[model samples]
Target chain A: MKHLLSINDLGADGINEVCRLADLFTEVSQRPIPKVPALRGKTVAMLFYEDSTRTRLSFEVAARRLSADVMGFSVSSSSVNKGESVRDTVNTISAMGPDALVVRHRSAGVPHQVTGWTSAGVINAGDGWHEHPTQALLDCYTIRDRLGSVAGRRIVILGDIKHSRVARSCVMAFTSLGAKVTLVAPPTLLPPAVDSWPVDVSFSLDAVLSDCDVVYGLRVQHERQAEALLPSLREYTAQWGLTVDRAARLPVGALVMHPGPVNRGVEIAPEVLDQPNATLNEQVRHGVAVRMAVLYLLLAADPDLHPEGEAS
Target chain B: MSTVIKGGLVIDQTGERTADVVVDDGRIVAVGTDLSGDEILDASGCVVAPGFVDLHAHLRQPGAEEAETIETGSWAAIRGGFSAVVAMPNTNPPIDCAAVVQEVLALGAKAPCDVYTSGAITVERKGAQLAPMAEMAELGVRLFTDDGNGVQEAGLMRRAMEYAAGLGVILAQHCEVDSLAAGGHMHEGEWSSRLGIPGVPAEAEELMVMRDIALSRFTGAPVHFQHLSTRGSIAMVRAARQAGVAVTAEAATHHFTLTDEDCASYDPVFKVNPPLRPADDRDAVREGLADGAVDAIATDHAPHTMDAKERPFDQAPPGMLGLETALALALTELNLPVAEVVGLLSWRPAAIAGLKGVHGGPIVPDAPANLCVFDPQETWTVDPHDTASRSRNNPYAERTVRGRVRHTIVGGQTVLVDQVMRP
Candidate 1:
C-alpha cells in the first residue's frame, strides 16, 4: 500500500485512490501554467542504473511540474559505472536528502533493496524482468479514464507477458480494480507462474479476444528470451499476434493498447496499434499527468518534510 | 603426530629437488632422506610439491544447493590434487559486502581444502556499478571480479583498478562485453556457422581483456585475466607481461584440450561463457602455458543442475565441472615435464593469486602442511559419473587420461587419502 512495487502490494482501496488522484492530476495538467505547490521544495531523485528515455524523462517532468526539487542521476555518466556499489551510491544519494527516490535497474529487487538502505521513499521504475509498478499505474489510470472505471470490463493482455514487468504490475492493479483479466500467450511466452496468478489464463489469443473490452499488448523482447523458449519471430507473431483482423474479432467496442516501443507487427498488428479505438497514444499523455500526481502524493506526505530544507 | 612423504622428486617454480618430506603437527618439519615419522606414504614414482591451486571454481551454496556446495567442491578439489582453490563470488546472494564474504568463509571452514573466495566487484553481478572493494579486501578477499560479466564501461574499470591498486588487491575480469555477446549461444565461428547456433565472437572476450590490460597499465593495478580463450587474448597478455605491466593470466584446462568442434553435436555440456574457441586458439592456450605466457591452469569449474543444463544447447547455461579432472587432463594432454606441469598447477598459480605464503611451499620446516601426493604416470579415464560435485554436467566424462590423485593435506589435515574423500 505504501510503495507500489507490485499490484499484489495494492488492495482495492489503493487502486481507487491512485485512480482518483490521477484523474484530478490530469484535469489540473490541462489548466494554464500547470504547476502544483503540493510538494513544494520536496526533492525527487530519479536514479536510473539502466538505460531509458521515457520512464526517466516522464518522472523528471512530473516531479518538476509538482514544484518539487529534482536530482537526476544517470548511470551512464555517473560514478556508478565506475565499480561503485549500488548500496554505496544509493546511500550517498540518500545523504543528499531527497524526499523520494525513483530507481530503475537491470536486476530484479534492486529497488526493493534500495528502499531498505535509505529513509527516502522508493518507487520501482522497472527492475529486470520484475515489476515496473508505475507503468501499471498510468496504464490503469488511462483505462479507468476511458471506461468510467474498468470494474466489470473483460481485459485481455496479449503478447510477451512472460518477460514484461508491466504485465505483472498491470495484472495486479486491474484484478484488484475488479476487472477480469485473461492473459493470452503462446504458452512459450507465459512464465511458469502465470497459471498461478489470480487471473484467467489462455494459450490461444483467439479464445479470449471475443469477450475482452481492452486488448493490452506487450513487446516481444526477442533479445532477452532464452532461444529455446520460442522458435522464429515470424512463427511467434503468427500464433499470438493481435492483428487488425484479430482486433475486429474481439467483442464490439473493444480497445487495443500497448505500452510503447512496439516491435511493429511482431506482437500487435501495426494497424491495430494505431486504431482510433486503441488507447496507446492516450496512455502516453496520461503517463506524465498520472506520474505528476504520484510524485506529489509521495513527496508531500507531511508539512515538516518541506522544500527549503531539501535544495541545500 | 608426524607423517613422512617418502621419495618424491619435488618440482616447483622455485626449483626441483628429491626429498623425503616430514610433517609434524600439520607443518612440513623436514625435507631430507631418512626422515622419521609416525606414518609413511610411498611416493617413489611421483612428483610432490605444494598443493595445486585452482584460480576458478564455483562452490554454489547459500543459493543453488543442487549444483555444488563448499564441502563437496572441496572434496572435488582434493581428489584432483588441488590443496586450495579460489571460489567465484556469484551465488544466490553474491559475495559483495563483507557479510556475504564472511558467510562464504564460514561455510568453507570445514571443507576438505583451503577455500578462499573472490568478492564480487559489482553488487549482485550487475555490472552497472562496482561493489565495495576496500571493505571486502579488509576481510581478506585478495581478488575481486564480476566474473559473469566484465564491467562494460572503460571508465568504470579504470576507477575499479585505481581503487584495487590503492588496496593492493587484484582485479580479475570475466572478459565479456554485454552488447557484443548478446543473444549468443556459442562461439561465433565455423562450428557455430555450420550448426546454425547463434555465436558470440572471440572479440567479445578479447576486447574486454585488452581494455583491462590497458586499465591495469593506467592504474598500476595488477589485473588477473580469467580463462583467456582467444589467441589474441593470450598474445595481448604475453605482450603486457613482457612490457613489465602488472598482469597475470590463466587458462582453463578446457581451453587447452577442447575446441568449438565439440559444439557441433548441440550438446549443452560444451556450452560455456567465453565459449569454446577454435583448435588454433586451444593450441595457443597450451603454448601459452608452456612458454609461461599463461601463468596457471585454472579450472573455471562451473556447475549447474541437471534440469537446468539438460535443456536445449542454446537455452542451457554455460559451464562444465572442472575440479575433479583438471590435473589429469593437463598431465596427459600437455605432455610437459612433470615438474613444469606442477609449476603451472601449483606454484605459479599460488604466486599469481598472492597465496604463496601459505599454499605453495618448498616442503621445508615450519611451513603450513598444505600438500598433495599424486602418481605422475598413472593412467586413468575421466568419468563425470564418478565426480564428487553435486551436478551431472561435466562434458569430459569417459575420456581417457593419465595421472591421478593419491592423497591431499591442508593445514595438516588429511582431507583426501588413497583417493578416498575424508573430512
Candidate 2:
C-alpha cells in the first residue's frame, strides 16, 4: 500500500496484514526499550492543517517508537498562517525528503491532493468529515484483539456521523472485516445519504444497543446544538449517550469503544467509562501500534520482499 | 476588410444550406455558391454557423485579473466560437452601477469579441437594496443579476423584478438559498455521504428556483434562472413556463455533462455552483436542453488560478473554466443534431443575452458577420494548459471531445483562423 489515505484503500487483505503487523508492534511497544530499528533511516512528516493534539502526538509517538524521524508542521506555527497556499506548503515540506506525509486538514481531500504534489506516501490522519484511516485501523485492531476476529461481530457507531471522520472510516473498516455494522444517530446528525451506506441506520440508539458487540461513540460537539442539528446537549445525552442504564443493559462480553477526546457527559456518560469492557484507552494504546504498522508498510517493510514468515 | 468563408454547410436558426458567406465592412455582403472576396477563410468540411453568445461568463476584470481579464476572456470566447459574451458582475467592486457597467463596456470595446456587462440586481450583489438599474439599463445592460448569489429576500427579489420589468430588463438569478447551501462543498448525495464532505442538498437550489418562479409569476416580470442543475428545478421551470410565466432557464455545460460522482476524486475542478448533481439530474438537464425547457446552454465560465484550485476540495473555491470547452463538450456528450446544438450555443443564448439582432444569425445580406466555422467531426483532446484564460481550471482537461472550431469571425473580423488565434 503506497498510501493509507482511506480504509477503503486498505481492503480486507490489506487491513488484515496491517492488523497482523500491529500485533508485532504491540509486543514491541510492551518491551522495556519499547522501540524498533525497523524504520531508522526513514522520515515521516506530519502536516496538521487542523488543530489536533492526540492524533498528532499519536503519530509522532508511533514514528518515534519505530525509530523513524518525525517532522511536524502545525497550521498555527507554520507559514500557512501567512497565507501560504496548500501547494506551496506541501512543496516546502516535500523538499525535505520525507518517506511519507501524515496529513490532517479541515478539508476532506487535502491528503489526496498532497499525493499529486509530492512523491511521499500520504496517510490521512483525519480530513474534514472524511476518513481517519489510522483511527479506523486502531479501532479494528482493538476489536480484533478482544474478539479473536471481527467477523460477524455487531458494531454500532453512534453520534454526529455526518461530521465525524472516525464514524465514516470505522464503518467501512468494520463492515469490510465481516462485521455487521449499524449506524445510530439522529436523522439531523446523520449524513444526508445515510441510507446508501452499507450499514443499517437507526435513529434511536436504544434499538441497536442489545445486539451490539461493540458500541463506538463519536464525540458530539456543542456547536451542533447551535447549528440546530440537535435541540441541546442535554437532550442528545438523554437520547444517544452511552448512559449507565444503557451500559448495564448491554449483553455479556459486549465492549464499548470511543475514538477520543471523549465528551464525557455527552456521547458517553462519565460513569460508563468506568465499565470493565470500555476500550477507550485500549483504542488509544492500539493507535500507536497500528500507525507504526502503517508507517512500516508505507515506508519500511516491502510486503513482496518480506512476505509472511519473513516479515518478523 | 473583405473575406469569404468558403465551402461549408452554413447553419443558423433559419436552418442549413451549402453557402459561401462573403463579408465586408462588418456585414454579410452575400451568401452564394461561388462567393469571392479579398481574402478567403478556408472552411472546407466545416459548418459555418452563427457565433455563440454566452449569457453567463465571469470576465474577472476590475478584480481577480490573475484568473481572467477582458482581453484574455474575450480571446477565449472567440476561440470557443462565441461572437459575444455577457460578463457576469461578481467582480471586485462589482458592476452594480452605471459606472462599472460603462467601464466594462469600454474595456470590451477593445476586445476581439463584443463583451456586454450584466448589472447586479442588488448593490454590491449583497441582496439588500436595489442597484441603480435605470442608469445601468441606459448603458445597454439589459440583463440584471446577482450571479454569485441569489437575491436572498423574496420581497427584495420581487421588488427587484418589478423594478427590472419597469426598466425593460431581465433578472437572472443564481438560484441557491444561502441558508440551505451553507457549509456545503458539493451536492448532497450518496457520493457526499461516502466522501464525508458536507453536502448542499438539491433543495438548496430548487427552493430558490421555486421562489423566483413564483416571484416572476407574481411580479409579471421575466426571470432567468442561471445554471439550473436539479431535476426538480427543471420541472418547476418547465411547469412555470407552460403556465405562461415569463421564466427562462439555462443549464451550464458541466451540469448536463458531468455528475456529482466525479467528485469522488475530491478534485475541486468538478466543484461548481449548483454543484454537479446525480446522474438523474444530469439526465434531466440533458432532457431539458433536448426540449425547450432549458432555453440556452450557458457556460457559467468561471476561472480560478491553479493556486486557488489546488487547495483541498472543501477549502478550494468552486468553479471550472467553461468558455474554452463548452461547445465541444455539448457536441460530444449531448445526442442532439448539429443545428440544435448550434441553436443552443448561439441563437437561443443570443436571444437571452439581448444580442439577437447583432449576433445570432440568418446568414442574410446586410446582417452582422458574426460567424463560426467548425468541423463537427474533428476529435481533439482537451489540454487545460492550452487555454486563452489566465487560469487553468478546465475540468475537461485530457477529455477527448468531438468538434473543433476552425475559424471565428466577430463583426467581419476573423479573430481565430485554422484553430489558432489571429494576431
Candidate 3:
C-alpha cells in the first residue's frame, strides 16, 4: 500500500480495487467540468525530472481536477541544477506540507525514497527506467475500458525497452490486473534478467503480434542512438519498426498505441498513430482520469486525511 | 592464511581423487591422505575442486554503487564458489581507458575473489569507434568487449578482432545486432504474440553471432560469445567450432534453467537481455553444456538497484546477479558429471580468462589454493533477501534447488564456510 514498487506487493484484491477505481474515475471524466472535490484543499506536488509532456501535465491536471493544490517541480531549473542532491530536494519539498506527492525522476527509486523524506502518500509518476505506476494504471484503464475485463487477455509492449519506463510499469500493472504481458525488444534493449518479474518474454516481434489484442509501441529516443543502442535508425525501422505491413499481421482486433512524440519512421509508422484503433490520443484522455483515480485513492480515499471524518 | 580442506573428493579437469589438501600462506602446501595445517576446516562429503572462475560479471561501481560494487560482487562470487571473475567494462565511465581498469582492479584487491577485468572494445560502447584495448590489454586485461553492445558495424568489429588478435586478447561479444533486435523486448515467439509484447527475433542475436563468427574467421581472432541464450546462436557456435574458427562461448545459468514461459508471469525478474529463449532453446543450452559447445557457465552477474529492476519488464535494467548462486544453479540445471560441471565452473573458464596460471585447479601441491568445498548432493532454495550484493535482483528465490557450495576459499582465504559469507 505504501510504494507499489512491485506487482507482487499488490494482490488480486488490490488490483481489482485499482481497476474498479480507475473505471469510476473514467466515468467521472465523462461529466461536464470533469472535476472532483475529493482532494480539495490538499496539496499534491509534481516532481518531473525527465522529458515528459503527457505524464507531467496529466498529474498536474488530475490534481487540479480533484481540487487539490498542485506544485510542479522542474529538475533543470530547481536547486537540482545548482548541485542539490535528491535527498535535499525531497527534504526541501517536504517542508511545504504537501498532502500527497507525485514524483517523476530519472532514477528508478526516487519515488520509493520519498517515503523517507515525507509522510505524504507517494504516487510514482515515473522513475528512471523504473515504474511509471500511473501510466501502467492508465494503460490498464484503457485496456479494461474497451474490453470487459483483463483476467485472461494478452498484452504486448513494443520498442525502446532498454530505456522505456512506461513498458516496465505497464507490465507490472497489466500482470497485476491478470493480463499476461510479453515484452518484445531487441536484445540490446532487453536487460539480462527478468527472473524477478512475473511476465513472459520474447525476442521476435512476430511471435506475439498475432496473439496480442493490445499492442503498445514506444518512442525510440534519438539521443540513445548516439550511444549506439542500435546500429542505424534506418536498420532499426526496417527490421523492428512497426509498419503497415507488420500491423496487418496482428490479430484482427488488436488495438495499437504509442506513448507519443512519434518518430514518423522509427518504432511505428506514422499512419498507425492516426489509425482509428490506435488510441494514441485516447491514451492522453485516460491518463488524466487514471491520475485522478490515483490521487483520490492515495490522498482522499482514507479518512485519516480528514481526521474529523468530514466527507466521503 | 593457513588452512586445510579435509575429507573431500578433489575433482578437477584432470580427474577426481580422495584427498586432504593443505594450504599455507595462500598456496597449496600439500595434498595427501592426511594433511595438517594451522587451521582445520571440515570438508567431509564435499568436493574439493579449484575455486570457480566466472567469465562475465558487471560490477557497477563508482557511478552505480547502489546496484553493486567490486566488494559486494566478489562476496557473491565467493558464496557462489568462484575464486575469480572477469569484471565487464560497461560501467559509468566505461573501462575504455587504463585508469578506469586500474580503479576496478584496485577496488578488487581486497575483495574476496581475484577480479580480472575486460576493457571495452568500443569507446563508451558506441559501436562506431574502438576503445583503448591495447593499453588495457597491457595492464593484463585478457578480454575486450563493449559487452552491453556488440560492435554493430562489421568493419569496426573486424578491426577490433584484428587488434584483439594481435594483442592475444579474446573479444567477448554480447552478440546482438541492432537491426534485428531493436524495439523488441522479449524473444520473438508465440509466447510474445500472446502477451502483446514486441518480440526480438532470434536472428537479432544470431545475426551478430554469425557476423562475429565470420569476423573471427576473417581476422583469425578468438571471440567469446557472452550469454548465448538462443538455440540458433548455440547451433551456429557449435558449427563454427566444428569448422575450427577459434571460438568459445559461455552460457548463463538463467538460459538453461528458465524459458520464455517464465515471462508469461509478467514479472520483471525474468526480463533479461537475450531474453529467455523458448524451451527448445533452453534444452539446446543444456545440450550445449553437455556436448562441450558452451565452454563455461558464466553468471552474467548484472545487478540493478531494486527500483531499476522493480519496474515493468520492458523498463528494468536487463540483468540479474548470479555470482552468489551460480555454482548451485549450474549443478542443479545441467545434467552432467559433477567433475564435468566443475570444469565448466572452474578450470575451463579459468583457461578462457587466462587465469589458468593460478585460479582454476587440479588441486595439486604448489597450486594457488583458490578452491571451493561443496556438498554436490545438498539441496536448498534460493533466497534473494540473504544475498551479499547491494542489489537483490535474484529471480531464483524460493525455488528449490539441489547442489550448493558449502565452502569457498579464494587464494587460501575462507571467504565462505557453511554457506555463509565470512565478510
Candidate 4:
C-alpha cells in the first residue's frame, strides 16, 4: 500500500479501491475547475531515468490537478549524466523533501531500490522489461468503464511479452480482477518462463481473437530486432499484427487496446488505432486520474500529513 | 613452537580415531592418546580434520581493494575452516602474467592462510588471446580461468584448453554463454516471470558445459566447471565424468542453499552469476554432491562493496561473500556423514586445486599440520557487519546455521584459536 511498484503488490480489493477513486477523479476532470484539494500542499517528484514524455506528462498533470506541487528530474540534463550513483541521486533528491517519488528507470527494480533509500512513498512509472503498475491500473480502469466489470472477461495480450513491462503488469492486474488472460506471441517474443504465468499462452493470434473481449497489442522495439529474437518485422506483422482484417474478426463490442507509441502496420494497423472501439486515448486520459488517486491515497493516508484530528 | 590439539575425534581421509595431534616445525610429529607439547589447545567434543580448501574465491586485490584484500580474505578463510584458497584471477588487471601472480603470492605470504593464485585463461580475461600460461605455470599457478565470464569464443577456448593440456594444468570455466545470458539478472524461472526481471535461461550454462565437454574430449585436457548451478549442467557433468571425460566440477554453497525465489525481494545480494536456480536444480546439486557426481564444494566467495551492490538488482553486479559460511552451510544443509562432509570441504577440493601434499591430509606423522577443529552441533546466526572481509555484502546475514569452526591451524601455527584470529 505504501508503493505502487507492481500490480502484484495490489490485490483485488486494492485494485478496486483505486478504480473507485479514479472514477471520482474522472468526474472531477469533467468539472469546470477540474481540480481538487485532495493533495493540497503535498509535493510529488518524478525522477525519470528513462526518456518518457507521455508518462511524465500524465503524472505531472495528475499531481497538478490534485493540487500537489510537482518536480521533474530529467536524466539527460541532471546529475545522473555525471555518473552519480542511484543512491547518491535519490538521497540528494530526497533531501529536498518530496512526499512521494515516481521513478522510471531502464533497469528493473530501480523503484524498489529507491524505496529502501527514502522514506517517501515510491511509485513505479516504468522499469526495464519489468512491471508498469500505473499503466496497468489505467488500463484496468478503462476496461471496467467499458465492460461494466473485469470479472469473467477474456483478455488477450498480444506481442512481445518478454520485453513488454505493460504486458507483465496487465496479466497480473487482469487475473487478480477475475479475468482470464491469454497471451499470444512468437515463442521467442514470449518470456522464457511464460509457461508458469497465470495466463494461458498461444502462438497464433487469429485462433484466440473470437473468444477475446479485449485485444491488447504491445509495442515491439525495432532495436531488439538486431538481437534476432524474431526473424524479421515483416514476419511479425504477418502473424501477430492487429491488422484491419484481424480487428474486424473480433467479437462485436469487444475492445481493442494498445499501450501507445504504436508501431503502425507492425503490431497494429494504423486504422485500428483510430477506430471507435480503440481505448488507447482513453488509457492516456485515465492515466492521470488513476495516478491522482494513487497520490491522494498515499499522501492523505500518511499520519504526519493528515494527522488523526485533521483527517476530514 | 610445538602445540598439542587434544581430546578430539580426529577425522581425515584415513578415517577416524580419538587421538591428540602434536605439531612442531610446521608438521605433525605425533598422533597418540597421551601426547604433550609446548602448548595445549582444547578440542573436546569436536572433530579435528584437515582445514578445508576452497577451489574458487574472488580475493579482489592489487585492484578493488575496497572490497577485499589478501590479508582480510585470508582471515575469512581461516575463520571458515579453510587453510588454503585458490584466488580467482578475475580481479582488475587480472593475474594473467607472472608479475601479478608473483605479486599475489607475495601478498599471500603474509596472510593467515595459504593463498594460491589462478592465472587468467585469456589475456586480461577478455577471451581473445591466451595469457602467459607457461610463465605463470612456472610460478606454481595450477589453475587457469576467465572466471566472472566464460570465454565466449569457442575457438579461443579450445586453443586455451590445448595449451593448458600442453602445460599439464587445469582450465576452469564459469559456464555461461554471454549471448544467452545477456541482459539477465537472475535465473529464468517462475519467479523471474512473476517479478518481470530478465533471466538467464538454464540453457545458457548448459550450452557452455556442452561446448567445454566437447573441447575437453577433443583436446584430451582437463576442464573444471565452476559453480555449476542447473540440474542439466550437473547431469551432463555426471555423465561426462562416467564417460571418462577428465572433467571435474565444483558447486558453490549458495547454489544449494538458495534459489531464484530468493530474488522475489529484488535484493542484489542474492543475485549471482549462473544465478540461483529453482528447487529441482538445488536438489540436483545436492544429489551431485551425495553421489560423487560433484567433486568439491567450492565457495565462489565473491565480495562486492556496498555502493556497487546498492544499485537495482539488474544494474548491480553479481556475487556474494562465501568463504566465511561455506562449511557451516554444508553441515547444516547436506544430509551426509561427517567424514564425507570433510571430504567435500577439505581433501576433494584440495586435490582439485592440486594442493594435496601441503593441504588436505590423513593427519598422520610427517604430514603438514594444516587442520581445523569444529563443533558440528553449534549454531550461530550470520551478521554481515561482523566479518573479516572488507565488504559487507553477505547474503547469509540473519540466517541461523549449525556447526562452527572452533580453531584453525595452518603450517603448525594456530591462526584462529577458539574462533578468534591470533595476532
lDDT (CA) per prediction: 0.81, 0.91, 0.81, 0.91
lDDT of 1 by residue, B1-423 (tens): 888888988666668788888888879889888787888877888777789999999998778888999988888899888888899988889888999889889988878788999988877888768898888898889989888878898988888888888898889989998888997777876555434356798999989888888888888888999999999999999999999989899999999988988875556788888898899999999899999899999999998987676454665789998888888889888978888888888888898778977887766789899888888778887777788888888888778888888878889877777898876
Task: State in Å the error of residue B233, model 1.
Answer: 0.6
A1-312, model 1: which lDDT tens digit per residue?
245455555566655666667777887788898787778878888889888888888888888778888898988898966867777888899999998889887755566557667998888788765678788888888887778777898989887776677887888788887899998887766754355577888888877778778989888877644556677777778888877778789876687888888888888877886677888778888888878766665666642212353321
Q: Candidate 4: which docking quality band?
A: medium
- The parts of candidate 4 lying over 4 Å away from their true place are A302-312
Off by over 4 Å in 3: A1-312, B189-199, B260-269, B310-315
Candidate 1 Cα misplacement greater than 4 A, ranges:
A1-312
Assess each model's interface with DockQ, reporting 2 decimals per model: 0.01, 0.86, 0.05, 0.67
lDDT of candidate 1 at residue B21, scale 0 to 100: 86
Task: List all candidate RMSDs to the true structure.
Answer: 18.3, 1.6, 9.0, 2.8
Q: lDDT by residue for model 3 over B272-383, one digit each (tens)? A: 8888888999999999999999899999999988766655456566877788778778788887889998999999999989987698887888888899998989988788
Clashes of each: 3, 0, 63, 0
Ranking by TM-score: 2, 4, 3, 1
Candidates sorted by DockQ, descending order?
A: 2, 4, 3, 1
Model 4 C-alpha lDDT per residue in residues B1-423, reported as the tens digit of each score: 899999999999999999999999999999999899999999898999999999999999989899999999999999999999999998877999999999999999999999999999999999988999999999999999999889999999989999998988999999999988998889988888777788899999999999999989888999999999999999999999999999999999999899999988788999999899999999999999999999999999989999889988887899999998998899988989989999999999888888988999989999999999999889999999988999988999899999899999999999998899995
RMSD of 1: 18.3
Backbone clashes in model 1, listed as residue pairs? A41-A307, A83-B130, A84-B130
**Which sequence of candidate numbers ranks them by lDDT, best first?**
4, 2, 1, 3
For candidate 2, the TM-score is 0.98
Please tell me which model should have the higher TM-score, number 3 or number 4.
4
* Comparing 2 and 3 on DockQ, the stronger one: 2
